[model samples]
Target: MTTTTDSPRWFKSSYSNNGGNCIEVAANIPGAVPVRDSKNPHGPALVFPADEWSSFVSAVRAGEFGNL
Candidate 1:
């Protein structure tokens, strides 16, 4: 089995232009979602399971987290 590292290629969300404090995520990793701070590329990344990450996104889009 081979392990893939997602330390590179962090893509910012298209809706992050106005919010300078937003974070970015590098999607479609081998088995996890790689997320990192947009202002700090050299910083550490937080990896999340695909299912959990998707649920979080869905909640955010559906206003489950309240006002954006």
Candidate 2:
């Protein structure tokens, strides 16, 4: 896990309107990108490499995840 002295600053997409199904992401951390369920702010977060997270976002923008 990436340790930090400060808590993550999580945020969701402006397009998110799926009620409790939305996920939040915190990319302000120095070395990692963290993601978690928007409905469960206090729950565990999934951490990923910044590059990997960027790739995933690009793929999502490109519709590579299909109808997601």
User: Which candidate leads in TM-score?
Assistant: 2
lDDT of 1 by residue, 1-68 (tens): 44477344568888777566878787757758888887787788898998899999999999998997
lDDT of 2 by residue, 8-50 (tens): 8889999998777999998789878989998888888999989
Cα distance off (Å), candidate 2, residue 40: 1.0
lDDT of each: 0.79, 0.86
Instruction: Report the number of the highest-lDDT candidate.
Output: 2
TM-score of 1: 0.82
Judged by whole-model lDDT over C-alpha atoms, candidate 1 comes out at 0.79
Residue pairs in clash, model 1: none
| TM-score (C-alpha, index-matched) for candidate 2 | 0.85
Worst 10 residues of 2 by lDDT: 1-10
TM values, all candidates: 0.82, 0.85
